[model samples]
Target: MPKSLQGLTVLVTRPAHQASRFQQLLAAEGAHAVLFPVVEICPPDDLAALTAQLVDIATYDTALFISANAVDYGLKALATPQILHHLTLGAIGKKTAQALQQHGFTAQWVPTAGFTSEDWLALPQTQQLAGRRILIFRGAGGRELLADTLRQRGATVTQVDVYQRVCPKIAVSQLKQHHEQQQLDIIAVTSSEGILNLVAMLDNPAWIKTLSLLVGSPRMRETARQAGFDGTLIMADNPSDEAMLQALIQWAQE
Candidate 1:
């Protein structure tokens, strides 16, 4: 028989627009999907700073995007294709690079091994950033290590938050009802912030004991552990849809 996740209800906590593929994958293996979209992405409230920074885009030696959302929002704000031809582009992960490529911009640098800030810092291109001006488009409040490390390496890094990620206020009631009914099985968290938000939503330890936890990386797995997730924690090798499905398949087999 096909590997079965029968009767297992997996909670996907990614943004709603991004959860469909993962939900379908789980459903194909007999798992019920509980969509508790804990995070929502919105363009930054104030765009003036971003606009001011972009005015000098041609002056920067490199521009970096840390996430696909950053690429999406950043491109949307630019509203024209001319800005891309002015500078070299760097992406922290394959997904981010792919996003840029889809928008017809190529990434000159991408992390080959791990897709974290530390991994980005270790890349050979980062060694000599002296006098180079780099623009980083990202969500609010994240990956400080990359920017800080770049500064220490002698690069002038200007980071602009093109988007914001906040817990979805609308999902509170649904999440509570699902927990009370014991309908949640596995909780899939792609970031450390998501994990913390999930924990905050639970409100009580009893509610947390009912679900398995799936994470997207070793760093996130460690974060889940630190946050007191006693349930099984399975890590997706990468954040791609295929890697996430493979993780689900492995979990079902065990």
Candidate 2:
């Protein structure tokens, strides 16, 4: 395989816990990855509430996970895997499904293409939901589209937050230092909120607008553009590490 990213420096703005795999991918391509975590994934404020929600897992006919963190924290809170056997598992993204598989669970439904709530909502199985009780496992303060749509379809939707997505205290000087040295080539942002957080963390952020901005989806790309990013915007096929790596390699080759 070709080291397509040789001598390049990419800024990785994923959460600290999830940055390792992407960093390793960049390193394998001979690119330097500068870790600048914009979002911090932390346990929810109330563990008892999370545990209580899972205690009634059998009541819900369907269970949907929003992200990998949701799958991890949600299952961890459950502790008893047998309780989940009654619920039909669903994951918003492939990564979330993989996370469930790691926990000895399988997602019966995953979106066909995209990794957003819209994609999952579009499924035929999700429609005609009259009296199906659904439980959503996700982080705090995410989009309400999934729950709203399900409820609109007459499904009893309950959202149980298992994790918290907090904006970490960021020192943009680390990024600025790389920019000053002209070492920052591209900045990778996974979520729409992450790009917003990165921009908010910087004082001027004009320098970063000049660099290539890599995003996972069109929604995220639009978010970056709305945040005043004027440089080249690269959209990965999906938010997965492999997708982002392939996107970077293809961009470099072109």
Q: Of the candidates shown, which would achieve the greatest lDDT relative to the real structure? A: 2
137 Cα displacement, candidate 1 (Å): 0.6
Report the backbone clash tally of model 2. Answer: 0
Clashes of 1: 0
Candidate 2 RMSD to the real structure: 1.6
Q: RMSD for each model, in Å, please?
A: 2.0, 1.6
Q: Pick out the ten consecutive residues of candidate 2 with the lowest summed lDDT.
A: 199-208
**What would the TM-score be for candidate 1 when compared with the true structure?**
0.91
lDDT of 2 by residue, 1-254 (tens): 65889988999999999999999999999999999999999999989877877787788899999999998888888868766767799999788888989888889889867788898998889988998999999999988999999999999999999999988986777678888988889999999999888877885457877899898998998988888999999999988899999999999889
Native-to-model Cα distance after best TM-score fit, residue 184 in candidate 1, in Å: 2.5
Provide TM-scores for the models.
Answer: 0.91, 0.95
- lDDT of every predicted structure (CA atoms): 0.82, 0.88
